[model samples]
Target chain A: MNIYLRLVYRNLRANLDRASLFFELIFPLFFIFVQGFGLNGIVPPFEIGNGRVISYSLFLAAGAVTLTVINGGTNAGTQLWFDRKNGMFEQILMGPFTRAQYILSIIFATLIIGVAGSLLVFLFAFPVLGASFNPSLSGVLTIAAALFLGTVFFGAFAIALSVALKSSETFQIVSTFAFFIFLFTSSVFFPATSAPSAIQVASLANPLTYTTDIFRAGLFDAMTPTVSLELGILALEAVVMFAIAVIVFHRIRV
Target chain B: MGVNQLSRLYGDKPAVDRVSFDVERSEVFGFLGPNGAGKTTTIKMLTTLLQPTSGGANVLGFDLKTEGRKIRERIGVVQQQDSFDQGLNVETSLDIYGLIWNVPRTERKTRIEEVIARFGMEEFRKMPTVDLSAGQRRRVQVAREFIHDMDLLFLDEPTVGLDPIVRRALLDYLKERVHKGLTIFFTTHILEEAEYLCDRIAVINQGRIVQIDTPENLKRRFGSARAVEFKLLQGSSEALASALSSSADVTRLVQDSGTGAYRVTTTRPESVIPEIYRLAERHAVTVSSIYIAETTLEDAFIHMVTDDENGRETERGLG
Candidate 1:
């Protein structure tokens, strides 16, 4: 096997714990089912643009998948801090592996988990929301692109933070705080178009908003010129974040 | 393997200062040093886990700076720190480590079983690594390294946290591997271990190689003087200390305040003992038990390090 693939397998296998499983798989399901249904009656139907009205439950289903991807990416990246604490970072580097291979393995592992968890959430929400599973080739491409770019963006962002932070406690606190800020400010749970001007600006700056918007556009067959712009911005952020992660990771000692 | 004038500097301070040494094939080369003595730093540089600030090294015919990956492909290092997948069980941790080294699945299984039984990890092999005791965790860390094959192995204090039986067993296992053409770079604070396993030993102090020779040769060179210790039954230790202080053979004489025994370091214990007995008779004092202590590697290491410190202090004073 290739060294990168082997490292990816190691990362996946090492993280098959209950905590990772629950947060990556089950926590998103809770949001999709319990919170999505509970908010269905309280919040009115959301117009995702293109005159396609959908229940709050259906709207949150897409957000749930987005949240799952974010969680997967964050978990994958934070694993570096744990590896450093446990000494595996230096140990693996001592083996037949370069620094790039090691960092890429974590990114790829996050992609795998993110995509898999997103699919599981989508499948679970299908029955509850009574949503149809039909899409054109372009729509499928848009969804795939959104998932890929979203995962890479968050994974790289978390990795950069993990490397730049001096201690694990600070990493955890900052990552958790960042996760909540990203969750509430984005259009994951509610429509950003109806929010106040300041929140709208914050949502526009958040990559999660772009991911959720692109995913919602693809799922509802609402392809518009704005979705393309969102996709382009998400792709650019992913590239820049990945570059930053690589630069920060290289600066780490052992 | 050859290292020439290799050094690693932390800012302006040199952690390993221009240390040079060669390790031959199928030999257990021991690196013995006190705490903070650059043994770990040297091992890290040789194993490619750390980069040297200056000078050069050639490991297994490959340049250290340009061919680190090639060198890493053939060498295994057991670092001083514990490393493992804490969430994984002992078996899985070993298997994953083998996989990372690109070991074949069937061969990995075989090696895992062999190391498990060899290291006596059967009882806790199924338990998570985080749940194991310190000694057990250290055992797993050492055993996992054997899952992959390497030409040269670097062990930095590998016997720490192990019991006497396990430590001996590990040394014997390394000896077996060495006999089968595996070269070992071993570091340890245990003098007896160095004496029993190392074909040649290097004593490093203050980031420099103080001495490098076989265990027996080091003892012969630096610890040639035998120590004669005797307790006075009827005589005062002060009298014996004063009488032995004038003898040409007696280079060092000190009295133990707690035990009231006199210890004399001399070039010839045979001459010093009889002289002490004659002195005791003249003083109307009786000599109780008396014995000559053998010079060991520990004694030699202490003497060499102490001598190096004194030399440095004298240089500083003169400067």
Candidate 2:
């Protein structure tokens, strides 16, 4: 087996514990099941701007998937921090791996976990929201692209954060604050179109907003020129964040 | 393996100065040094973990700077830090390490069982590494390195937390491996271990090589003086101390305040022992016990380091 693949396997196997399973799978499932179902009665249906309408439950389902991918990215970056603390970072570097190979393995592992978690969320949400679901080939492609680019962006962002921070407590505090900012400012729960002007501006600047918008457009077969533009910007953000991550990670001492 | 003027600098200060050495195939070369004497720094550079500021090394036929991957693929390093997958059990951690080295499945399993039994880790094989004691964790960290094949192994203070039996077992295991054509570059603060296991020992101090020779040669070179000690039975040894100090063969003499035993450091113990008996009889003090103590590696190491420090200080004073 290739060294990168072996490292990816090691990462996946090492993280298959109960806490990781609950946070990566069960936590997001709660939002889809409890939050989505509870909010279905109070929140009205959304006019998704393409002559298509989506229930609040379906919108929350997309947000739940986005949350899973975000957690996966954070997990990917924090794994590096924990490995450094436990001395495995130097240990692996002393083995048959270069720095670039090690970082790439983590990024690739994040991608796998992100995609898998998103699919698992969709699978579990299908029974609850299957009545209003409509599928198309182009729609599925858009969702796949959104998930891929979103995972890359957030994974690189969190990795850069992890490498830049000196202590685990600071990383935890900052990442939690950053996650809340990303979650609330974006169109994950409520549409940015209906939100206040200041929030709308913040939502427009958030990558999560683009990810959630692209996901919603795909889920409701409401792809628009704006969604395409968001996809392009998300790709650019992913590229820049990944470059920063590589540069910062390369400078880390053994 | 050969190192030529290998040096690593932390900012303006050098952690490992321009020190050079070589290890022949199947040789257990011991690197003995005090704390912060650049042993770990040298090992890091040799193992390709840290880049040298200035200098070069060729390890296992690969250039240290250009072919680090090749060197890493062929060599194993047991670092001083404790490293293991905290969430994994002992068996899983060892198995995963073997997989990382690309060991074959059958061989990995065989080696895992062999090392577990050899290291007495069977009782905790299924326990998580996070819950193990420090000694148990260190044992696993060292044992996991043996699951793969390598030409040379670098062990940095691997026996720091092990018991006497386990420490001896690890030393014997390294000896057996060296006998089968595996070269080992070992570093430890324990001089006795170096004396017993190292074919040739290098004493590094203040980032420089002070001395390098076989264990026997080192002891002989820096530890030529023998200690002659005699305890008086009845009378005071005040008369005997004056007589022993006047002898030409005796270089230094000290009388114990509590035990009333007089110790004499001399070049010739045969001549000094007879003189001590004659002097004790002359003083009406009967000799109760007497013995000539041989020099040890620890004694030689202390003498060498202290002499090196004093020499440097004198040079500074002259400058």
Candidate 3:
């Protein structure tokens, strides 16, 4: 109920109705639809010895929520830079809230929007992927937590960029660059097991890869490692990224 | 907290030099300066947007360097440029601002309507900001400052491009807010806005405050003071010049009417007037019409700022 918290709340709420708002919310869903159902006819990544034609669509759905989290950071951070360029940043700076509050507000708002998109992905995953894989309620909860962590981590990434990039053009370039780094390199759209030996090691090192692997493990019984250890790794990455973001935010001029 | 000589610099030159000012309980302080005069720079420091290079200030007694959050909580700011989300309607914009402070649902609706009415944006409540006119959008931007109560408000060029009617309304609203016990700091290029609205003003040029005073006091300080114009029945330049030449306080004298009258410019009018009377009577010149004129703020501003002693200086060469 304090002004700082209230300010954060108001900022996020306004973001909900923006054009970027719908795009941030729906972009992940699009990724899910294309990767899930639309990609059924693609021939690559096909290991046919098992006598089964697999649908990667369901597998893609499992990663939707986590992808949205990363997008949240990039989109929100880019928008912040745009606002600053337009002089709107000065208006917020003149208000009675700390920079930390401003950053936290964006992160929290993105989390909500991220979750909404992810929940839709979760429901879609169940029907297309052929029901529960016995990961249990705890496993399901574990995946949700991982997705949330990934979302927060990326959201922080965006805030950091927004604070650092003074110009809207610079922000766009950085966000675009960061998104590519997040995609292809991560295990979101590809199986970590089969990626190039070099990329496999990098994927393991990537936070998004861990998030996708953690969620994929919950959806498919084929995952080798237990969900607990994967959850630990995701949480650690989230904490480190989040702390760095806060420090970066505190260092900003406004 | 009072702003204590807060300033900024770009590499070598100071964007704002050691500038100091204090706001008490409910005063409306106007910062009058031309473009790039450190008006925005000073406000940025006060609002904790930019850190000071040499001197620092406080807000509501909170140290700007260390306690920015405390300051941010107790003040409202309207920047020089409009920054509202173009995607949102007027009604939604207020709701979002209110939500930022976490106002309760019941109070938010009423507050939104009240602010809309106060800012005269009721008709545009459901209209997207992108669709509104420049003046309407500006009204929304200013209206954002009123979503909730705050101890102080900072307005940076709040009425730019606004017509006289809307500008007056905005000024009146600001006055009302100050009357309700809110300390308001506003910046303007328009001298009339400062003259009519500001309780006290600080005029800055090239990142430094050249003068700070009431408009009247500034006029007196820089203006030509008493202006004596006389219609001589049969006066001569030699007689008037000789009579007024002995006065040390007179700035200048012009005897160009050719009708035997003089327009005397002086600070010591009391002495000059008597000299003029005696000179006229001694010369037997009949005095027709004589009147003394006072100085104005515009004249004072032109004298001190525009002139820079001669009205053209390095700082204003191209501007």
Candidate 4:
């Protein structure tokens, strides 16, 4: 097996020992159920810019998937922090592996968690929401692409934060603040039009907004404005964040 | 391995000063020093974990700076810190480490079993690393490195929390591997371990190499002083001690209150012995049994480190 893949396997196995099955796989499913069931009754239909009405439960389920992927990004930082504290960071660097290989392992491992977690949310949300969810091959491909790109963007962002901050406590505080703010201020919970004007502008600039928008269009066949533009911006942000993460990780003191 | 003037500085202070040393293949080169004396810094430089501020080295015929990866590929390291992945069990930790080194599955399995038996890890092989005792954890750390083959191994205080039996077992195990052509760069503050295992020992102090030689040679060169102990029969030990203290060879003299025996430390044991007999004869006191005690490596280490510290202090005072 490739060394990077072996490292990823080890990382995933380590997380298994820590009982992360709940947080990574089940917690997001819980959110999906609560949002899909609890909000479906009282919440009204959400209207997109294209003048198409989508159920509030479907919209919130998409948001829940976004939350799952974004939460997956923080796993890389948490794992890296554990490695740092336990001395595996220095030990692995002293091995035959290069720094780039180490960073790639973290990225791939977190990417797997992101995709798998989001898939779990999507699967569980379908039963509770009772919505039409089956899609064509192209739709599945689009969802995969969006999830991959979004995972890379958020995973790189979190990896950079962990490396630069170098403290688990500070990283947790900063990442939690960023995760809540970005998720709430975007179109994850509600449409940007219904939010305050200040938040509309904030959601316009938030990457999560573009990611959730892309997911909504790809997974549920919901019509949203400027799908192509959102994807292009998401791809650009991923490349930039990933490049910054690699460079910053390479320069970090062993 | 060859190191010439290797140095690593932290801010303005040189943690490892211009240190130069060499170790022939298969030799256990012991690095001895007090805490923060740059022993670990030098090891890190040699292992390519830290970039040297000045000078250079070669490990397995690879340049320290340009060929670090090649060197890393050929060497193994057991660091001073407890560094196992706590989430892994003993078997999985060893298996994963072997896999990281790209060991084949069949071979990894064989080596894992062999090391588990060799290190007495059978009882805890299925236990999580976090639950093991410190010694058991250290055994796992040391045993896991042997799964993959390497020409050189760097062990930084590998026996910190081990019992004496386990420590000796590990030393013997390492000695066997050395016979099979493994060059070991070992660092420890345990003088006895160095004396027993090291082919040559280097005593370091304040970021500098103070002395390097075989254990016997080191003891001989720096251990010239001896302790001459005896009991006086019928004379005032105070007068005898004062008289012996006056001699040029005697550096110190003290009488034991319980035994009424005096131990006189001297650089010239032969001269001190005769002077003691002459003094006993003149004082009209009978001499009891007397013998010269050999200086141990611990004594020599203390003497060398303290002497270096005092020299530095005097130099600073002069400046």
Candidate 5:
């Protein structure tokens, strides 16, 4: 546990400076404003298929908060790549810590980063979008759980990709392409029901679509009938991705 | 530690062939070899970084295959390549390394300062590792490994980029550690380092242990042949070469390029020196300067490695 904490502390200390603050804190806020106001005037509000209407900015705020977590996960993988390239990976392995401890340190660190980014997004949302974060105990817990598990899911996905790709350049290109594709195919911008038939098909296959739905439902007190099923699928996907990450992490050679 | 036919095979080729040697307690065992010559491979197996392909070894009284973590806990390694956390300053890098080794915070603080002072790293202790020069980064890399207490240390060319003074300081520090009961498995291509530090030296070539003995003994054994070098004032069209070739003691003779000098190798430099001067006088050639030079350890190393390569080539031709 001491080793894990030291690894986490060092990782966070190295990355959580003012330069990172711009990306993790201020830059995400910039995305929220641009994503909220830029399209709010031009695009119509989403109906959400329940006879209740919300501004496109509010919908984008939900996606933007979740996007922060996803980006945090990718950053975790980038850190791993850097560690490997700079010889820290081999150095750590030569020490008393196990490979599992190192991977867990990365996952937990990114989870913290993701949660912090999400809170900042919500804090900015109240003033920028005039949105209220008032939720029931259950709603707050569900949103927090989604953020936690979503970070783990994306974090594991990123690590798996990092392990499979040899070069950081190739890893960066593929991850960027995949993140955008994941965002557009999901219900981040529009409701899944309102998306085109092709995107709906892709979104159904995307774990993010359910993440946005569960996340939006928790925040706005709008619960879908299939919320329980979406939560189950998301939990299962997170577990499988986490397991794959662990397996891949073990298989990596120093 | 004892190794019994330890080997590591990559595909069909053996990176470390069936080789065995022993390291006594507190011994500075030097592994000398050129690049791609299995020195690193052997170190990896002994340090628990790489497993042997088809052999057995005991490190610190623990089996290599079953008790890797036990071996790892007791050994420190400084790999040949440059490795440092670019995100960390020199001080943090040392601190984190101590933390990983489970060194208590109070003791860790004391050891970090000691190593910093010992390694002359006070100037760059606060500098980020990436911002430091290659030699400074290497100093931090070597210094950080001493933060943890270990029974044995594996240093693979740890002094690659260090300045002469720093390199000598490192060697002296390591000698001090060895005096305090630290066993070191050292590897380097630099023969002088091996001569100065190693208690027993192993010269490996083509994945095999070509020779192993004390540095002085190996020198006397393989390096007994001396060179008699002399510059001729004029002569030597073929007369001196023919005259020196008739002597039973002269093993090889070659003329120096553009200097009109000939270097003659012989087991008896005392007798061969006079023989060469006599031959020059008889051939009506004037001698400019003559000196007997003892064979260096570097010469012995090259001679052993090249001879091994030639012997293997001859065996393949016969097969």
Candidate 6:
């Protein structure tokens, strides 16, 4: 446990600086801000000024969580690529550690980033965007559960992808393709009911969709499917992705 | 820990072909080879970084194939490439290493402090790794291994960018650590490193072990005697060769292109110096640079490996 925590600390300290204001927070938060700017442009000015402050804020918060899972996974995935190129992957693999510890370190590190990234996004959305963070006591609990499970799914997917990629170029190409799938199919851009039937079906299969929708529905009582169904999908995705990640990482020779 | 007939493949070619060796308790075994000769490949197998192709190996008596988890628990490794989190200070980096090893919290602080002190790194402990020079970073890499006394320590080209003084310091540190009952397995390309530090040397070239022997034994068997050279100053060759030939102390003979000097080889070096003076007196030829010399290790290495035809005139490389 200490080892895993130390790994997370080292990763955070390693990437503390950035070139833009967005660097102060995770990529998910930055993306949510961008989405808010888009929302402001599309909707009338009164929509924000009206009593829908909690609605707008929750919308932004769900986007933040979705962005969190996606970006956290991709960023953590980059480590293995760099390690392979620099020969450090072999170095770490050769050390006196169980494969479980090595995998656990990476998983825990990324999950923390995922959770923190989304929460920071939610915080920023509440104040600057003139939105309310208030919710029922159970609302907060459900959001935490949804976010935690979502992290496991995305984090596992990232690890498995990192190992499958032979080169950095391939990883980037695939990550871009998948990021779009996450963006358009999931309820990130708008509510699933508003999406086309084909888009709605695809969103149902996307774990990020379930994760984001559940947070919005449970936390803000926003338009959503049954909360229990969304939670079931998120948990299933977490289990499947974790199993795949374990198999792929175990097969890695260096 | 043991490795038996370990083999590894890179594509179709075997990078490490059936390499088998044991790292005994508290022993410092040197793995010496030229670049691309598979030393790193062998280390990867023993450390469980790469699974063997056909053969199997063990570390701390754990099977590398099935019990890889157990194998990792008992050893330490230093890779050729730097992998310490460069964002942190030297001290913090060592702390992370200890932390990953699961060193206890009560002992972690003391161990980290001791490591900084042990490596004479008190001043640089607070400085970021990015600011340090290559040698300083090397010190941190090495210190990470000693932070806790693991069963075996594997160092792959540990002294690659260091200066002579620092290289010696690192070698001495290994010696000291070995005296404290630590076992080490290291790989290096520098021949002098093998000569100075290894109990026995394995010279690998082009993915094969050319020879493995103690430096002294190799020298005694393959090393040639010294060459004798002298100047010819307006002296008759018939008289000089005749004067040198009668004493029966020399063999291979050649004349110097400049100043008509003569060079010869002989087994009787001690007596031959005095005979050179008598020959100079008899022939009245100049005897220049006639000091008795001993063959160096480089000469022996070249002589041993050169083809048979080249072996006859192996002295040419030295002369």
Q: Which of the numbered candidates is closest to the native, going by highest lDDT?
A: 1
lDDT of 5 by residue, B1-319 (tens): 8988999998999999988999999999999988899999998788776779989899899998998888889999998878887777899889977876888999999999999999999988999888999999999999988999999999999999999999999999999999999999999888899999999999999799999999888888888667778888783548888879779887678887777678777768889988878887788888888998778677577667867887999999999
Candidate 3 C-alpha error for residue B183, in Å: 2.4
Residue range B177-293, candidate 2, lDDT tens digits: 899989999999888999889999988988889999999999899886667888878745667788779998887787778887777777688899999889887888899999987
Off by over 4 Å in 6: A1-3, A6-57, A82-87, A127-138, A166-177, A222-225, B105-123, B205-210, B224-319
lDDT of 5 by residue, A1-254 (tens): 37778888877765444465457666557766876789889988756634557888888888778888788888788878888888777767776667788898899889888888888878877566887667888778778878888888999999999999999999999998998898889987778888889999999878788788888888887776787788888899899999999999888875
**What is the interface RMSD, in angstroms, for predicted model 4?**
1.6
Q: Scored by Cα lDDT, where does model 6 land?
A: 0.70
Clashing pairs in 5: none
True-vs-predicted CA distance for residue A89, candidate 5, Å: 1.4
CAPRI class assigned to model 2 = medium
Candidate 1, superposed: residue stretches over 4 Å from native: B225-288
Question: How accurate locally is residue A212 in candidate 6, as Cα lDDT from 0 to 100?
Answer: 81
What is the C-alpha lDDT profile of model 1 across B39-86, one tens digit per residue? 999999998888899989999999999999999999998889988887
Better structure of 3 and 4 per DockQ: 4
Q: What is the C-alpha interface RMSD of model 1? A: 1.4
Better of 3 and 5 by TM-score: 5
Among the candidates, what TM-score does chain A have in each?
Answer: 0.95, 0.94, 0.80, 0.92, 0.92, 0.83
Candidate 1 colliding pairs: none
Candidate 2 vs candidate 6, lDDT winner: 2
User: Docking quality tier of candidate 4?
Assistant: medium
Worst 10 residues of 4 chain B by lDDT: B232-241
**Least well predicted 10-residue stretch by lDDT in candidate 1 chain A:** A15-24
Q: How close is chain B to the truth by TM-score, in each candidate? A: 0.84, 0.83, 0.75, 0.82, 0.84, 0.71
Steric overlap count per candidate: 0, 0, 14, 0, 0, 2
Which residue window of length 10 is worst by lDDT in model 2 chain A? A13-22
